[model samples]
Structure formats: C-alpha cells, structure tokens
Target: MADTISTKQIIKPENLVHKKSAVMTDTTMHYCPGCGHGTTHQILAEVIEELGIQENTIGITPVGCSVFMYNYLNIDMQEAAHGRAPALATAIKRLMPDKYVFTYQGDGDLAAIGTAETIHSCNRGENILIIFINNGIYGMTGGQMAPTTIVGMKSSTTPYGRDVSLMGNPLKMTDIVATLPGTYYVTRQSVHKPGNVRKMKKAIHKAFEYQKKKKGTCFIEVVSNCPSGWRMTPVESNKWMEENMLPFYPLGDFKVPEE
Candidate 1:
C-alpha cells in the first residue's frame, strides 16, 4: 500500500492563526494601540454575549473617540450629537422598553457639553446604561481640556497645566450621578491593569443586570487611558492612569439599589 499521510498532519489555516476573543472581532479597531476604549469595548461586548442581550441591545454613540463605536459592536446602534447621547438613549429606551439601551460617552461629551443631558437623564430615572469614559483630556478634539481633566494636568488647551482657580476641579460624574434617586447602580472602574479590568467587567455586567430588572439608570464611569491625547506611549499611558488617575477616581461600586 502507498504511504498514507495522517489528515491531522495537514495544517488548518484557522488553526495557524491565534484565536480571537469572543468579545472582540478580527476587525482592526481604530483606537490607539494603548487606548483604554478597546479594552472597555471588549468587556462590554463580552457582557452582552454572556447575558445574551446582543440581539436586543441598542447603543448610542456620542461624538468622541467612540463615535465609531457602532462599527465595532455587532448590535443595533445610533449616532448621537456631541454630548447628546444621554438624551437620545432616554428617548430610545422610553420607546422600546423591551430592548436594552446604552450610551457610550466621553468626558468632554458627558461631563462638559452634555452635562445637562446626563444629569437630567439620570435624575429622571431613565432605564438605560451609561458608559462614561473619563480620560482627562479630549482625545478626538486635539487633546483639549475636559471637565474631568485632573487638576494640574496639561493638555493642548491647558498648555501650562490645568488651573483649578480658572478652570475648576475635575468633575466626579460617578459621585454626582450616584446622588440622584433615579440612579439604580453607580460605579467607577478602570482598565489600567488586569485586576482592574476584571473589576470593570463586573461593574459593566452589574449595570446591564440593573437595566434588565427595569430598575433605573445605571452609570459606570471608566477611567480610561488616552495615549494619543496624553502624549505618552500605550504602556506609559496605562501606568500613568494607575499612578495619577486612580487616586482621584478609585474603582468600585458607588451604589447598588436594594432589592
């Protein structure tokens, strides 16, 4: 008999390539290599898959680095004007109570320009999830000063460091949102490290669960890294977030409504 080669010996193209995480697709993300947005996006996608809400979820993309978020998440999404994601999410959730609604917003979009929308949405007890990304500077706007910019941090606009006297201190959205009776769950987490990433996933899951219960607004503020805006390499950006940002914005659940 002729020599027979084992079928197993044949290399499979799929096997040769590394397996991609279920949470993320093979599509190349536009975020900077070290940008925290990619990590947070993965976590959110994982949570959606785990909860089996991907089909029923609708995400609102705000005008920021995440304006292209709809391109990444394989779910129904709508683009909202700058800082208007909360208002759009509110209307969507109100109309489609059976569907899951969420808004992905940045510091400048949420804390500065959309402050009114964010506050009113939370105050009105809107049943939606708000994923607020606070990276201290405006990533998409050429590193401009943001409402959440830490005191003494320098940005393109604040070339000489953030002046608390003239610009005001960093706004703590999680703390402010938690105070609203309409808010069902409020947490602040980060993606600077593996441990923190795990915690952030938990917080994201919890926010979704709260929405499932039709409780009220659930807000999760993620202290993310903006390497391009921060003018640091991806590795250094993560490290900087840990050393300088975490102290001001600790990661943990700020509030959870009682059953």
Candidate 2:
C-alpha cells in the first residue's frame, strides 16, 4: 500500500524580524517590550559599523539581560560569567593588542558581583571599552535589588523600598570608575529620549575610537529604563528616569584624555 501526504509548512515567529540596517543582524531579541537594551545594542552596532571595526572588534558579554548581545551585534563576541566581562575584556585585549575589545554589562553584573573586577580592570589601565547599563535592578533575575538600586525604589528584594540603613545607598559607578587614573574616557548618558540617545551614540563612538587607538580604558554608563521592573508603562518609565534617576546620576562626561 502506498500513501501520499502533504505536510503544512511552519511559520516563523513574528518577533524574528530581519534588520535592514547593516549594523543589526537578522535575529529575534528576547527583551521585553519597551526595554532599553535593544536601543543600546543598535547604537553600539551602528558605531562599530561607522568606525569600520567589526572585523577587529571583540565583545565580552556578561550574565544579564545583555548575555545574548552576541546574537544581535554581528561581531566576534565571548560570553563571560556574571560581572566578569571587564576582567575577560582585559585578558582578551592584553592577548590581542590589535583587536578592539569591549565589555557590555548590566548594573547588577557590573556594580554588584563584578565590582572588584570592574575596579581592578580600570586600575590596570587595560585597553578596553566598558558599556555599563544601569537599569537600577537585576533585570534578568526577576528584578531583585541591585547595588545601583536607588533608595526608595522598590524591587523584588526591596519590597518596601531600599532601606539605606539595611541595603545601603545606590552606588554611583560612573563616578567611581572615573576616579581611576588609567581610565582615559568616562561618560554617563541616557537612552530614554531621542536627543539623549544621539548623545549616547556619540559617547559610544568615542569609547570605541579610544580603544581602536590603544589609548587605555574607556567606560560609558548608560542610564537605562526598566519598565517591567519599575511597574510602569514604557512612557512612564522614561519619565521616571528623567525625573528621578537623572538627578542622582547626572549625565555628562566625567573624563577625557588629552589628545
């Protein structure tokens, strides 16, 4: 007995849209709606493309929302343990001096578990660029309290607002990292508004440029919005960042090396 049958084709997920821009690749991002990580990823990719460093660039991703950054940015990337992106970046840059090395990390991954790694890497004057995303909570692990969680901001761990007496005040990582003598460039920018996004792109470009020139460490902290964790609509989250976060983490260039 012979039987003939036709199988229906499966449709791909709608979220898997191909990016027309050369900077972004054809891949689906796992970020929640209105998340800022996608915006930051695009800016970084655009900067890398504009500077023509994709071939020579190496990205170190940490264990956070950005852990899958390699899938978005069409470049060489290596995954590192939580908060160890900076340390891994240092080693990579040291081994391959000609390569453009950068680390993409979140607030919890950088300011908390990776605090020592971040500080020591900066102190060593490693030729690397650090893209620090300070969203104020541990986005990947159910929005728990992070080292940068502002006082009075409630998280999974700090259900009744962050208690300074128990949890301590938020750590200003940009200011702290800027104090290291080896750091060549340091800036804090936001991704909420279009104007600020443009400024952030410029800052990212400068950081990559410094790394390309082997000018030492360049650290950029992007004050991002976490709408889901903040329990607000995307629009409201942006407003919250402008109103509350900006005052505590003022946006500006902390340091720039002599030309």
Candidate 3:
C-alpha cells in the first residue's frame, strides 16, 4: 500500500509567501473576474496595515466602479456623489488632518465630471492621495467612451472607434496634474503583470508616506483593463492595453518630490 500525505503536509506554512491583509474584510468582492480593481484593493489594504494606519485611515470613493471600495477594505470610508470623491476627500482631510485620507476614483469619475474637483484639490496642494483607475472607458455605465479613452479606441458609444475630430482627444489627466504646482508626486502604473503590481504597491506606499508629511497631493493613475467593457477576454484585454493604452498613457513616475 502506498502512503498518501495529507493536504496540509503538501502545503506547508514555511512555503507561504503571501496572505490576505487583515485590513481587507471578508466581504466578497463584486469586481469582475480578472479585473484589476481587486488586486488594487488588496495592495492598498496591505499597505495600510503595514503602515499601522488601519485605525486612522479614511478612504473616499465616488460613483463608479470604485464606489464599493468601502465594502471590500476594512477601514473608515465615505461615499461621494458622482465624480466628487476628490472634493469629499479634501473636506475629510481638512476636518481630520491626522487621518490618512485618500480618494479612489475611476476614469469617468476622476477625469470627467470630477475634473474640477480633481484640479482644484491638487492645485491647492491638498494633503491627500488620489488613486485614479483609468481603464479608458466607463466600465460601470455600459462601457461608454470616457475622458481617458485613447483615440481610435472603440467603446459602446464610439462603435466606429474614437475619432479626434468628432470625439475630441483623450485627456491626459495625470500629466495635466503633474505640471501643477500643488502636486508633490505623480505617477502612472498598471497591475496587469506581477512586476507592474509590485511597482504600483511601491508607488502607493510612497504616496501615503508623502500624505503623512502633508507635502502635497500625490496622484497615481493605474492604467487598468476592462475585459467586459472592451469586449475581450481578460488576457486579450491586457494585451490590447499594453499595445494601445500604454503608448498613449505611458507608465512611470511623471513627477516626484524635490528630494
């Protein structure tokens, strides 16, 4: 008779390299399979827990795919009106300066209706972090063309692909804000690959540190993929994003602190 080892023996604790952060609740995530939002939330929770700020952190998210972040992350959270996360975050930070306040926003929420809030808050050097997820389309609202949608990109609204003359050009919101005086750090990142995920986590950690210093606004744009919205499988969407989206919205630190 052949002896069989138990499953526990096959998987040992010593081999465990990763575990869910306690800062994340057990609530089931509603994000689509293979969506980058879940990964982003995990990294965020890990960072908050690592910094020992779970009890003091406050996150604000507006109407969009990111609106339900509070349900996933175990931290103080606020829901804002459509595209108003930045405004809400600004108010929260002002009232409670000691709290780690940040806004989680999607492309439509951050680059379109909330553009004014995003601009003014950064212009004033609001001591908060802004996590912008730019998937190039309005993922929650039926995959419509968003402000960050690249030219020649096709969405529900632009079935023939986006035309610069008809639809105007894509908004480089991250670059626009980086040039403003109030921004201390600005970067564009992605989470489709393991290396990119690590880079994003590092950027987020640094952003929170800067927020602790009350230096200025730290804007990080995560160029993610919308598999359902893009009418492609998760793998295809990632490939498309790398080939088309990244070229228009390159990933890297656009601006950094003087030091």
Off by over 4 Å in 1: 1-25
Query: What tens digits encode model 3's per-residue C-alpha lDDT throughout 1-259?
Result: 6599787876887877799989999999998888989989999999998899999999997798877888999899999998888888989999999999999999999999999999999999999999999999999999999989899999999999999999999999999999999999999999999999999999999999999888999999999999999999999999999999999998999997878
- For the record, the alpha-carbon RMSD of candidate 3 to the native fold, in angstroms, is 2.4
Q: What C-alpha lDDT values do all the predictions have? A: 0.88, 0.88, 0.93
Q: Can you write out model 2's per-residue Cα lDDT over 52-142, one digit (the tens) per residue?
A: 8889999999999888888988999999987899888888888999999999999989999999999999988898999899999999888
**Candidate 1 total steric clashes:** 0
lDDT at residue 106 of model 2 (Cα atoms): 95
lDDT of 2 at 22: 81
Which 10-residue span in candidate 1 carries the lowest summed lDDT?
17-26
Best of the candidates, lDDT: 3
Q: lDDT tens string, model 1, 1-259?
A: 6598676865677656433446455678899888889888888888888898888999999998988888788889999988999999999998999999999998989998999999999999999999999999889979999888888888999999999889988889889999999999998888878898888888888888778889999998999989999899999888888888889988788997777
Span of 10 residues, lowest total lDDT, candidate 2: 4-13
Per-prediction TM-score: 0.90, 0.91, 0.96
Give the poorly placed runs of model 2, Cα more than 4 Å off: 1-20
